[model samples]
Target: MLERRGVMVSGAAAVCFYEVCPTVDQYCQLRLIAGLSEKAKEAAEMALPKTVFAVSGYHCCDLVAMGRIVGDGACHLQLCDIAVHPRLQRQGLGREVVLRLTAWLDKNLPPSAEVSLIAKGASNLLYAQYGFVPTAPAAISMCRRC
Candidate 1:
């Protein structure tokens, strides 16, 4: 079952509706407007359904922010696709998305499960507030395009 809530974005004076998942079209458009990597429709359709948990903020039906977790349900989980529209950045919607995702994780994850995300740019700072730490020296994040 998908959860829904409404919040007023500071400074925008608009009520943003938050829901558990975004439609494939909304997901792709949000990624593009938020300066995240582009995702093909087929790829997004394949990916969104696999989310372990997801949160999307929409203002009057337009996707403004989103975050999602994807991984095996028990052992390893990765937070990915965090994005906020440029106009909505710093308005607390991104934080709200993360907060919702993490809250879900807290309730669902087993004690031994590992949660991880590849933070980009200054996003690590925001994520750090939620108990994420830099895994440098002892561990490094490595990725390559398929």
Candidate 2:
């Protein structure tokens, strides 16, 4: 057991990081809690395996958070699909997930690697604490529908 901000965390309720993707059901549930759109199970199944790397946080066997690293391993990398269960937020579980993923990147990624993550408005601060900076006009993020 561990203590954070006066709260007792346990193997069952404290955050534990795992180097595995959550199940499709777990993914959908966590995303919904984190306010992301639900992905089709078929698409998720096809894509989850293609993830270059993934991390999940569990508390007492309950999957509470997840994140993924995608794109070419050497030159291009993006952090996507980060989510922390709504009921479990504000307890640093999200930070733990990101930290574990970034720590892995630090050791495994080549020197030429470029990493980026698209953040929601409120989450920019959380990410900024981990060295992420806004690129602004220098490189605007763009997206288009297929």
Candidate 3:
């Protein structure tokens, strides 16, 4: 695993045990706590089931961070909904979440599988650390929201 800040995680992130996927309620709540906007509960319900792989970090029996890999696992995949609770920020939990999802992709997906994520602001730096780079000048990222 890639170390965070040249140091192995030894705090909440290190202690948290990750599940392959969290319950829908857990997924939504984690996102909300991270200051992400809330969506209809039904939307969350539908989305959670579609994830190809997900990782939820738990510390002291409470869910503290989360991320999900969605899209076609074989040919293309997108990482989304990565968040760590405000109280849990800076504990490496966010990195741990990404690490888990990427590790799963590396092990399970074929080499031909293409992975991408739309990272905003400073989060780009974090994603870059995991080998995600800008496709700028080649391909641009575009999105449509409902």
Error of 3 at 36 (Å): 1.5
Residues 34-142 of candidate 2: C-alpha lDDT, one tens digit per residue? 8987888888889888898888877777788889999888799999999988887887777877777888789999878989989887898888877788989799788
Badly placed stretches (over 4 Å) of model 3 are 1-14
lDDT (tens digit, per residue) of candidate 1 on 1-146: 54467676557557465657789998998889989899899998888888888887777778788899999988999999999889878988778888888888889888899999999999999999898999998999999997
For candidate 2, the per-residue lDDT at 9 reads: 58
Order of the predicted models by lDDT, top scorer first: 1, 2, 3
Output the number of the TM-score-best candidate. Answer: 1
- The sequence of per-residue lDDT tens digits that candidate 3 reaches over residues 16-123 is 555456677877787788888786789988888888987776665566777889997799899998988787687777787788788888899998899999888799
After superposition, candidate 1 runs with Cα above 4 Å error: 1-3
**Which residue ranges in model 2 land beyond 4 Å of their true spot?**
1-12
- Candidate 2 TM-score, true structure as reference: 0.87
Question: So what's the TM-score on candidate 1?
Answer: 0.93
Error of 1 at 96 (Å): 0.8
